[model samples]
Target: RQFGEGGAELFHSHRAGGIVLPTGTVRVEKLSASFTELPGFEDGAWWVQDAAASLPARLFGDIKGLRVADLCAAPGGKTAQLILGGANVTAVDISKNRLARLSQNLERLGLSAEIVQADLLKYEPEQLFDAVLLDAPCSSTGTVRRHPDVPWTKTAADIEKLADLQRRLLARAVTLVKPGGRIVFSNCSLDPLEGEALYRAFLAGTADIVDDPLRPGEIAGIDPFLTPQGTLRTTPADLELGSPERSGLDGFFAARFRRAG
Candidate 1:
């Protein structure tokens, strides 16, 4: 209502809960400040987040009473979503500065979580969680449109390096969640070797974890993104679909796996 009238031509990511985006919107590409300065933001109704970026947190369905971990969580947009979705979240990140932003975001949203500052590989919890979200560090090629610096900053060697790091983080994330628990692993990279291929290898080597395919209508407008294995491979351009407005999303891949109990 307000968003539409504001000349932002936004789309509702879902009727239930999500940040409404101006149709064809990209992250941080400023819309009119009217929406931002409105009472909704000032009143802590919602925080800024990319629509595609929000999907990984939603992969763990109905985690109301479940304990979850946002491993490598900094600038905690997904952490807030988990908290709102009824999961008790332990947000972990390596950087103090990034954690500080996450803390401030949570506070503004009137949400709360247990915050841990430590490296994902080195950090160990006394008990594992029921679910975990790992939005790993990547080459950022998928985010080139929103983050123009990504193309200039990342290299092929960097992609390989990040892929290796992603594997390490996924391995650690698996250990942090209980058997039968799910790990939603996501990376903002378009490379198959980095995302799809790497996860396929992880599945081959690890017998206990199995791929959990996403179903149609589970997440609105998700059909085109599904790969044969049921993982999600999202591109920035998908949302536009010939829309007259400028639209796109960061390249991102997400997969869900549940450990064998």
Candidate 2:
């Protein structure tokens, strides 16, 4: 249902945040507003997640009943998305504590998934999945707008170390998918070294894998952020839809690939 006149006025006057995504995701652009205090949250009508962070899982068109592995999937945001899309998800993370939080979230959302605690490097499944999502660990430079201290907390060397780790985790994710299966690799770092450069290096070496670029109009408001090679790259400076205080998305990069049959 469309908003009534009064509702529309309120929504516009408050300058809410991002456009409503197809998935019904409503981004909270007002940084000072306590989103949790709003209605619908208590009923699990929504969950907290940066709009940019919510894009990678959506690269999978229709995952109904598809088996998906979510590597390094703690806090369960993407995992929850996949489950909502009707995918059978195995959410894996190394931190037991984080997995516990994920469990709580899933329960609150009335969603379910097979949760596992394991280091991605050593994780093994009895069956290969139709797809895998690797939201690898990174320097998290993309979120500096929300956490200004991020730039001072890490170094180039730290980024290099994290990039290497992401490369390995991505490689592992590829192995877990069956032939012709898809993989969406992503990280929350603005540096190309941890994103574009790293994926390119891996693609150059992996002959069995091929890029599966996003189709035009696949994601609403996504055209401005797409790379020429069809990857999604968003920075805090992108997505200028609101006031200067709430105009950009978090820095994130993501690419999709398919294994040769």
Candidate 3:
């Protein structure tokens, strides 16, 4: 049942025997049907952005005329969000193939950005930005509900490797932001090692805590789930247990940081 060429067939064959429901239908079909009905997919007003993933664009407060960089910007969902929020965005990603997809999205939305295909770990822009967002790549555990096949594909060692890469990307992003500018570090991951732990390690030596505005009543009974300083964590259960409309959100974690002046 696997459709793609890259190890997908093996993954699908293995998964086919692992889970079974009363209806005897494939879970993938059910998931696809649910996704197609989501608001973002129909009118194309917005893409499927995790509720928590939207927080980073707001962290900068005012970006109307500011220079912003979205590193690791492939598949450009965040890039589009930033532009809609009024930042003059420069979207960077290492893959030309992925950037092609990003370009298509921008064209579809009638939005534009300086899309650069370069390895952010080594690429440098001619000018610095007022703010930057490093939505670093990581072991995507937070997406488990939407991507049930992830846990079967990834391993603990993969997380460790990604953590190291994230650290490097954060350091580079910090270097690119002006003093007093902001950077929001985020990952679609529930692993504290990749989310909170990565932020803590970065803040320990550079940057400082900054307030993150939460939607009123967003954290009703989950104070412990809130970071000590009020970062946000969107969980699968939070979505699944809510009304059908709310159940469409993907799991995510996000934190905002400010460069020390």
Q: What is the C-alpha lDDT profile of model 2 across 1-261, one tens digit per residue?
A: 012113223333344543454323454555445765654444555677777888898898899999999888989889988987889999999999999999998886678999999988998899999999999999999999889999899998999999989988888888999999999999899899999999899899988899899878887666777888999998988765545544577899999999878
The residue-by-residue lDDT of candidate 1 on 1-261, one tens digit each, is: 111122222323332222334322223333455655743565566566666787788788789999999998989888987887788999999999999999988887778999999999999998989999999998878887788887788788888888999998998888888999999999888888789999899988887788777887676656777888889888878676565343667788999999878
* Residues 1-261 of candidate 3: C-alpha lDDT, one tens digit per residue: 101122222223443221211111112323434544632333344354455455555556668988999999988878887887788999999999999999987775567999998999788899988999988998888788779998778788888899889888888888888877888888888788887787767677654434343443353333323555667676777633434433434466777776666
Top candidate, metric lDDT: 2
Better of 1 and 3 by TM-score: 1
- The TM-score that candidate 3 achieves is 0.75
The candidate that wins on TM-score is: 2
CA lDDT, every model vs. true structure: 0.78, 0.82, 0.68
Candidate 3 colliding pairs: none
Sorted on TM-score, best first, the list reads 2, 1, 3
Deviation (Å) of 84 in candidate 3 = 1.1
